[model samples]
Target: MRKARWLIAVLILCAGVALSQKASGDDAADRAAFEAVCGSCHPVSMASDLRSESEWKETIEVMVKAGAKGTDEQFEAVRRYLRQNLTNVNVNTATAAEIAPVLAVSEATARDIVKRRTEKGNFRTIDELKQIPGVDAVKLEARKDRIVF
Candidate 1:
């Protein structure tokens, strides 16, 4: 019975790892598609300026109208990637999970941001956010445009 239980646990662990890997692979492909489609006309660096979902959708529409070329699958992948990884967040109102991906911060640091906000109230400025311990000031500065308070 113990051996059977151990085998079951190992199978579950393997399945979890496999799923995670597949998700990561999908993300990588999506990112590549975004770069290929967007890079055709403008530098991919320009995309680092985070936008809202509607804004990204509109931008993609404009680009397509203006002659950006990609398959429907590629365009969809690009859209999904942008929405998942590049969209902005309202830090004052956003959950830790939302903040973590947008700001490229760890979950622990994101939780700390929530804790600080809970204790002291909403953040009004970059300087205020920079004051949070364990939060990277430079990274915050780099993504300042993506942050809304």
Candidate 2:
């Protein structure tokens, strides 16, 4: 009985280790997909800042239109990886580079945002984003959850 119990305990421990490793391996695959697909155009850091899942989807769509290539599975993996790693960023204090990717806006728009913030102080609410020229209020409203003041 003692020997049987010891064997059972060892088997359980081994199974746990195996399961943990499999989870890590899945994460590694997602990271690989992210690097292979998105890193082709820009550094992985470009997508490291947080955005809502919807925002990520929109960004991915734009990238596809812009000639970024990847399988649907790979794109899904990259999106999942981005969603898991990136979270909400404070737009009020974020740089143009940081805001561009996270907000899924043009670099010019990001520069405008930074410039506006510099001139007018921090944004008090998402509604104020409309004050910036070329910012679509409807789109900004859709992504409000990812934008923080």
Question: Per-residue CA lDDT of candidate 2, range 69-132, in tens?
Answer: 9998998898767755664557788777667755667889989999988998998988787878
Q: Quote the lDDT for 44 in model 1.
A: 84
Query: Which candidate number would show the highest lDDT if scored against the true structure?
Result: 1
Q: Which residue window of length 10 is worst by lDDT in model 1?
A: 46-55
Alpha carbon lDDT at 149, candidate 1: 90
The residue ranges of model 2 lying beyond 4 angstroms of the native Cα positions read: 89-149
Q: What is the number of residue pairs that collide in model 1? A: 0
For residues 40-114, write the lDDT of model 1, one tens digit per residue: 988988888678766788988888899999999999899878866689988898889878877878899999999
- Report how far off residue 110 is in candidate 2 (Å): 32
C-alpha displacement of 119 in model 2, angstroms? Answer: 41
